[model samples]
Target: MNTTQLDYTDITEIRGPLMVVRGVDGVGWDEFCRIDTGDGQLRHGLVLEVDGDLAVIQVLEGTTDVVAEKVAIRFDGAPLRIPVGDGWLGRVCNGRGEPLDGGPPVYGREMSSVAGWPLNPVLREPPSQPVLTGVSVIDGLTTLVRGQKLPIFSVAGLPHLELATQIAAQATAGGEPFSVVFAGMGLTHADAAFVRDALDDRSAAGELALLINTAGDPVIERILTPRLALTIAEHLAFTQGRHVLVVAADMTSYCEAVREVSAARGEVPARHAYPGYLYSDLAGLYERCGRIRGRPGSVTILPLLTMPAGDITHPVPDLTGYITEGQIVLSPQVHARGVYPPVDPLSSLSRLMRRGAGPGRTRDDHLDVAAQLLGALARARQARELAELIGAGALGPVDQAYLHFEDRFGRDFVSQRPTEAHTLDQTLERAWQTLSSLPRRELTMIPDRLLDAYYRSDHG
Candidate 1:
């Protein structure tokens, strides 16, 4: 392999955010490069493609005011690598890992590739531990598990960002050494500020590392932010032995960037005009989480993406549901009711919750209570529909009781302040309180032992 720096001045075609170099020798793909323009300004670039004697370069800061003949490009003979270690905590960096908080550039003794090292499938342990997100709708029903990739599926105009940031600011792993790596892609200025303000105390306490790529920034940076953030998280979780949760928001922007670049390169498009390798590309990021055998630490991921026009069958969410464990779906109808989290219980699910929330992990009665609550909610929905068809005054007592249960469940179990964080026990208590609105005989999913011990008829 060539390890020597090579400089080229061959004149070639220039395109949007891309430069084609002629007469290049031994230039490798993804290799870093420095671009010096005639006006004495230096820009960063990445090697996108290489044939025998020609290479395509992607300008990181874009190709404005860059003259093809006046620019000299130098290959650094290596792929993109960044300083990685404990020094990243409490720091805010841009997509390229450059400091944005007025602090000096983050440095450490070791540098790691942004493209992470793959984990061996044989060495992975099944996820069996709970990650408390402090939201009753999630913790009580769709419990997030360690070493899982559970995405939040939302549509535009919903408060998915608020729910994601709140979870990142408050999630914990039962008194263990925990940290959060939050990456925001193509965020507006106000959205970025909200993230900083929400996690300010956590950052100050050395528990957070934030990376932002704003709407005004280069689109190429949006493609790099999650990879860089995950590289940092893998360092903290695997090398240093700490539980790390990665929260990446607005992945829709990231996919758009991928589609934009694909169009630039003239690659054949797949569903929804995205690159054909979209599933593989997303797997490369989401599959980076999990626990390795004999290792005490874990990396859990909760990525948030908006569904275009609320279409669940869209390629993004559809492919994500195939790659991830399950999804936590946010609803506009529930948000209209003024619920803080607005998670639709009928739509949201955590496929690994059974393995993560049963006896010895969260509580012995956790599964039973979850079953009863969900069953009651399903019945409540039917009763409400029935009431709409037939006048409420004509309903039977049992249906009326179900309608009452629904109101209590939505208010007591689903609604909470944005800043509120509930413990697992508190969440279960609220579940029991909501169930008490139904008759004792109606709660048949819960075991007799737990019903006798925890059931209270006062709410009924």
Candidate 2:
């Protein structure tokens, strides 16, 4: 807990959207502070940078028309804090978690700061639980393990929006007690409406809660949105004891917001013009999700980041990959070739995959079948490359078969949209259908029971 709070003293300058202040101690970076005009008006600012006795604050409300000498800042002795409670469900809130739907304020709830997350005790049970979104690729290959932090990395022009909506609409865990805390960072009005309408029409909006900050909103608001969303998730998982899935979309914009605040504070820049704290900044958010010991419910996070120009090497994605458990990457190049969801299997992976997939959980043959299918697909792709080099006219029958495998795998598997989300069983069934296209001798990797159960004709 923060001890010894400080009182406001003097403001040096009110630069556009920032302020310089003096006479404060223990005001750490990103700590929220309140400024009073000394005339019954109050505004909020975050400690942007600290230089000995001086601290730079970015006024979230903007520093306009407020004379320097009249300004007084009350150091909260901590970063911006929000109340987490079960009452927040089914309600809409601002970036700060204050109710925007004409609901009551978040008072009487245990106050927690936005930085550093609570980790579940290691001796606690491991997360073998699965939260199905009905999306084939996610459910079958990259299963979403409860308490894991999975990020979706995408480039512009992919169907990430559509996939996000489909997940919002259909995300479930065997119809068990569950809830959703969805936050949209820097979403356009259309995308915002798309999310709202998806939840509303499905009547899941009531079970679903939202914290939306549009692209036009202040950059600082983006920083606040996801925390508010996860606070709600934690409230449900730890307090109300309900399974919760928290989704934060377009974290690329969130990173931009971090840069904006960093720039306002005049901090040094990092790769691709991001702040130096980008890695720890993301870890602070991703670290929040988990299944606490003895808790009946768990909180899972699915944070989305858009890689600029499809470059995963971009600092935002690079740093994110380092912190997150795994990534679900979307490919625009594949989408252009007509693959819905457009996930690049080779590029994406789920680090917590084994915990959520297996017999009696997903299916007995899931791991082996998925691996073999992936291997076959890789071989087929190689064969297609060879055909391209040696001319298809001279290709052997086996190579010709591999070409067919490559073509159908792209069309039948990758081309399926999220709207047509398949259950794990359906996905595996489809996998077997495709596998039947290969010779029986090549099916050596599959169990005899599965080989008989699913290997069929008419794979395409």
Please provide TM-scores, in order, for all candidate models, with all chains considered together: 0.98, 0.90
Q: What is the C-alpha lDDT of each candidate?
A: 0.90, 0.78
Error of 1 at 397 (Å): 1.3
Tens-digit lDDT track for model 1 on 1-460?
Answer: 3456667888587787788889888788888889988788998888889988888888889888988879888888888899888899999998888999999999988898887755789999898799999999999999999999999999999999999999999999999999999999999999999999999999999999999999988888888899999999988988888899999998889999989888888789999899999999999999999999998889999999999999999988998999999899999999898887989988989999998998999998999999888898999899899899997888998899999998888899999988899999999999999988888899999989999999988544
Best by lDDT: 1
Candidate 2 lDDT for residue 315: 92
Candidate 1 regions exceeding 4 Å error are: none
Off by over 4 Å in 2: 1-9, 25-31, 37-41, 48-53, 64-66, 75-79, 100-109, 116-125, 202-205
lDDT of 1: 0.90
